[model samples]
Each structure stands twice: as structure tokens, then as C-alpha cells.
Target: MRPNREDWAAALAAADKGRVAALADRIRDRAQVDLLAPPREGLMLMQLRESVAGAAFHLGEIPMARVHLRLTAPEGVAEGGAALMSDDLALVTRLAILDAALVADLPEAPEIEALLAEGMAARAETQARRALSLDRTKVDFQLLSEEDE
Candidate 1:
């Protein structure tokens, strides 16, 4: 199944860094990229809510990077932006370029989609492993009346 655009940034961020860099470089070589604003790196507050009270509170600060840029290829021009909870500005910038390239339907869009698929698969595998580990530790509690029966 095709991934939704809303999931692109997270999938791209989790993709192989070397492949991402190579693809972004190739796109840059063929397209004109203009940064809408200087790439940014800073901390963002992490928020969480209590399940019972449904009250929100600051979890902590996380390092983040964001990029906004426009890509102009022969096919068309497109804009993309990425904000990720990571300190790597270059990676975030590359992800933004890839996002715009996909939006513009550049020749490299297929490769970008492949990378996204690989990333999503890897993420799913990791989640499955974690779930198995949790399941191993699961405890079943039985009430005294049920146990007596």
C-alpha cells in the first residue's frame, strides 16, 4: 500500500542515511533548490498528557531541526518542509529536498518511494520485536473466586 503524505517525513527520517544522502545529492544536481529560510536547529518542548486526569504537562525538551525549501525541476516546482526531533540539520535538509522532489514528481521519485517503503518496513519490524518482548513479560491476573472455580 502507498504511504500517506503525512507519514513521509517520519519514514524518510528513519530511512538509510547513506541512501538518503545519495538520492538527495542526485536530485540537487538535477534540480534548482532554493531554501525558503535558513535551516533551523533548536530545542522543542515535549508535551504529554496524563491518562486519568487528561491533563497535559511538559515531558522535556528535545533537539529538533527544520527545513523549508522549494525545488524547481523541468517538470514543475514544488515546496516541501520537514521538522524532526533530531539534531541533524543536514539530514533534515536532505529529507526536505526528497519530499519536494517527490511532490514535484522528479525522475527520482520512485527511488524515494522505495526508500520510504524500506524505512516503514524496518520500523514495523522493530515495533514487532518490541511487542514480542513485552508479550513475553505479560502477566495474567486471576481473581480469587475464578481461581477457586
Candidate 2:
């Protein structure tokens, strides 16, 4: 995916909690942050469809966590938000902080970029491995002809 603001946000959200925390630590030391909305658990409805133009259906409800936060730095103030598919409060908080930091153009932006690259690489590897395994199970068959007497 193209490396843009939204991309960074997604990357941060997809990253491991430990990795997000470690990346956020790089900016937390020098930035002032405020949590406008504390991380909280919630539920969101999931949707699915059988085909591109197929009718949609409600799959089920999934756990979610979200937070809205702001960061103040020498450069300026930046607002951020985080919504997760899981109810990981800490991870959402970290992602929100990182989002604000990236928006604020903190010195740690480069590090966050690196982390994004690493996450993208890992995801690609996982997808490749899964595809390879799936390819092995592909089935092929042909129609047989009956003998004529």
C-alpha cells in the first residue's frame, strides 16, 4: 500500500502491541499527550457478501476498542483516533498516541516508518506462505468416457 497518513494509521493499528508501545516510547518522552476519550470497549456489526454485487448480510458482532486523543509538541497540536477489531484497550491507546505523534511530525516519524515497513513485510510473508499452502491443495479432474460395445 502507498505510504500515506491513512496507511501509517493502518500499519500502526495492525502492528503488535509490543511494537506499537516501543515505537510510541520514542516520542512520548518529549511530547505532551491528552486522552480526549479514554480507551473503551464496544461492539460493531460485521457484514459479509457472497459476491461483488451480492446482497449483504450481517455476519455477527465483533468486539471493538476505540480512543480519541491529542498530542502537543513544539511543532503543533495534532489529534488522532484509533478503532480496533479486538478489545485491546492498551493497543488502541498506543495506536492513538502513535497516530497523533505521526500527525504532529514528531522526530520519531522515521522510526515509525521503519516499523510500518517491517509490519508490511511480515504481512506479505504471511500471505505468501498461506497462498503457497493453499496452492498445494488445489484439485484437478477430468471427465471419463464410457467404452462403446
Candidate 3:
């Protein structure tokens, strides 16, 4: 299944970087892309919420890159934007292009969807490995009372 708009960014971020770049480059070569806003690179204030107190606090600053652009392809035209926690402006710009292509339902949409699936699968595999590692170190504590009984 294709990822929804809300999940599109995450899927793109998680997918293989080389593959994503290739697809983005292909779309870019055939389309007229106009940057709606100059590609930006800066630090974003990281925020976090405390689970216990339900309070929000600024964690720290994280390097971030953002891109907003419009793509005009033969099939359609669409605008796309991407903000990611990295200082790679080119990568972010490429992501924005892919976002536009997918939204435009350009001929490359299926390829984009395939990239998303590959990324999601890789993310799931990484999570599973982490869980297994955690489980290996898990310690079950026995109460003193129970031990005596």
C-alpha cells in the first residue's frame, strides 16, 4: 500500500538514500522545478515533553534542512516541502522534488512508492534488531519473600 501524506516524509527519510537520490534526480531531470523558498539550512530547537509532569521543554538545538519547491511535469504540477533533521540541503531538496512528483502522480509515482516500501521495511528490521538486543539483556527480579517461600 502507498503511504499516506502524513507518513510520506518519514518513509522517504527512512528509505535508502542512494535510491531516493536516484529517483529524485530522474524526476528533476525531466521536470521544471522552481524553488518557492530558498533551500534553508539551520538549527531547530528540539522540544520534548515530560511524561511524568506533562511539561514541555527544549531539549537542544538540532541541525536541520528544509526545502520548498514547485515541480511542473508534463503530467501535472505540484508543490512539495520537506523539513528534516539534517544539514544536507541537497538531500532535502531532492526529497522535496520526490514529494512533488508523488503528489503530482507523475509517471515515477510507482517507483517512489516502491522506495517508501523499501524504507519502511528497513526501519522495521532495525527496530526488530534493537528489540532483540534489549530482550537479551532483560533481567527478571525475584522478590525476597518469594525466594524464601
Best by TM-score: 1
The global Cα lDDT (0 to 1) of model 1 is: 0.91
Name the candidate that leads on lDDT. 1
Q: Candidate 3, which segments miss by more than 4 Å at Cα?
A: 134-149
**TM-score, cand. 2:** 0.76
lDDT of 1 by residue, 48-139 (tens): 99899999999999999999999999988999888888899999999999999998888888999999999898888888999999999987
When summed lDDT is taken over every stretch of 10 residues in candidate 3, the lowest stretch is 138-147
Question: Please, what are the lDDT tens digits per residue for candidate 3 over residues 1-50?
Answer: 88677667667888989989989999999999999998889998999998
| lDDT of the candidates, in the order given | 0.91, 0.76, 0.89
- Residues 66-124, model 2: lDDT tens digits: 88988898877899888878777877777778888777777777777777787777767
Clashes of each: 0, 0, 0
Candidate 3: clashing pairs of residues: none
Off by over 4 Å in 2: 13-16, 137-149
